[model samples]
Target: MRPQCDPSCFVADHLKKVPPSGIRRFFDIVCEADDVISLGVGEPDYITPWHIRESCIHSIEQGETSYTSNYGLLELREQISELFSKKYNVEYNPESEVLVTTGVSEALDIAIRAIVNPGDEVIVVQPSYVAYVPSIIFAGGVPVTVSTKMSNNFKITPEELKNVITENTKAVVLNYPNNPTGATMDKADLEAIADVVVDNDLMVISDEVYDCLTYEGEHTCFSSLEGMRNRTILLNGFSKSYAMTGFRIAYALGDSEIINSMMLIHQYTMLCAPIVAQLGAMEALRNGNDELDKMIREYDRRRNLIVDGLNRIGLECFEPKGAFYAFPSIQSTGMTSSEFAENLLDDQKVVTIPGDVFGEAGQGFLRCSYAASKDEIQEALERIETFVNKT
Candidate 1:
């Protein structure tokens, strides 16, 4: 046998630097358990709408199985263009400014890699999505954290934003109608942040995957604000809104030059997004509105149910107006987020993600997704009440 090199040596330094996702450990534990209710994954509980599925099935039956253009199907791109114009009041050249990615996840990755040079610092607002920091690190860039507090409902202020940005700073990643916290920025607030971005001469990668799911207020697209469209990379997808996560379809929109740059990396690496998924997404943009509205109403009902249930049970939950997560402060249990989640799963067989997985600032909280059925949410709340009371 040949000599074995040090195991660590085989991996890239950046790959070694980042830890595995904290969410996955609990997922493994969940898969091994019986009769467990999981409020863990950030996925919708609904099925993809039948019309959208039928569109894809029709395309396949017609033998439209070949690769699409590196950009994407023109019809899908035009639909996305019309949606942006109608909803966000933003204009995008469907032929030039839109790049259909494998998912919003891929759009984010390619955007970061395309913009960041070695030693550049990317400001990441936390406690945000788990992927942002590691993605920055993976791109040979530095991730500087700007922690938003519960007092501000997790909206990053211009002051907090200014503190972390340095001369080496290249970009900022924003997620609103945010994950975990369910925080949303009002239009005025987003405009204020837009001013900071303009003054700083910075580029922004705005992940609006959850934008359409807002409950209390409208989601002001970052690109819709003055001067923002030139600098903001708008990322969205069918995963959350249309309940089509399995489709693996999303897109990035920006200035044509930046879109071109991302396309270069994407073309060489991914070639094209899946044609079947593109067809499904086209139908989703055209016919999925009613189904989306129904799901949103249901999510709102369950969101109200669980948030009230948690507060009644003595765990403090802020009213979340966006996304379907209820992040309840578990501090009174006197356990770290991990300890609380672990013990609750073991003792009660109810699964929730420890908030600290998102960032260090998430330590005192737990993210309980309300994307499950109402019955499941009711049952999970009941078990959580039991666990909290006995503790």
Candidate 2:
């Protein structure tokens, strides 16, 4: 006879404190179902452009499959640097200030680990991405949340920001054109937040992965703000914009010292992003703009379709200005966010993410990604309406 061992002893204490992603439970349910319409995952419906895919194939055929510099291919870095300079007026040295990462997720993780010390507080604006809180916890830093309100279009104000600052506060994590809620910050909104960050002498980790998906207004790069260039780690990548999520290539731009610190962690853990993906990304930056524009136009169309349909069904959806999600209040159904999502999936064969998974403030709401085709969005909307009417 053998004695059973406790798995807890093998896991790290910080990891044990964290819960599994709220998004994963629904994913498992989805995988088991048949003929289901889903609005859960935040992925593009479009395929990678042929030119970009061809670039990767060409690179492999040429036998360029070995590792590059830990900092990544200089040509890709230079392209990234040039894009930032042309689009957002922010400049970074390709050699020192740019570090190509496995993904924006990796860049985010390494940035958190590079800066946070034990007992330090990192302010996370909520209803935020599911990864932010866990990443902070893993780095031995406390996550202090400041909830953004729907009344303010989910944009955090300087007043809300000031309430959370303390002597031990080290950084703030921001995701505008946010996930779960497609709220975006205008220049004035970000400028107000910038004032608070400067006054407090805090660092910022800005994830602008969805920058190219904005529909209503220009995407403001946070690092472009006055005095913010040096203190901000600007994270962006090809995942959302170029329909290259599978490639897992992204980059971080910041002061050389911070980039160097993140590089130290990257060289040991990730080494460098896949060279083939890097080659694909280089092609994306150079020649994929036309295909990207077409996809954006289609997403805007779907955004209008879903938001209108949700409101017509009495769900009370706010118009999302950027990204591809439609967050609608389920309060009229008299069900909690979780109850509504679960019951809808069970009753109508449609899938959505309960908003509370993003944060406590997300209760009474649901996140429906409009990244599916027009036909799928229409069918999901109809199914949701049927479920809502029956309730």
Q: Which stretches of candidate 1 lie over 4 Å from their true place?
A: none
Which stretch of 10 consecutive residues in model 2 shows the poorest summed lDDT? 22-31
What clash pairs does model 1 have? none
Instruction: List TM-scores for all candidates, in order.
Output: 0.98, 0.98
Across 1-391, the per-residue lDDT of candidate 1 in tens digits comes to 9987887667887898799888878778778989999999889999898999999999999999999999999999999999999998999999999999999989999999999999999999888899899999989999999888887788899889999989999999999988889988998988888888888899999999999899986888999998899999999999999999999999999999999999999999999999999999998888889999999999999999999999999989888889989999999999999999999999999999998998987888999999999999999999999999898
Candidate 2 versus truth, CA RMSD in Å, comes to 1.1
Please give the distance, in angstroms, between residue 5's alpha carbon in candidate 1 and its true position after superposition: 3.7
Model 2 lDDT tens row, 79-164: 99999999999999999999999999999999999999999999999999999999999999999999987888888999999999
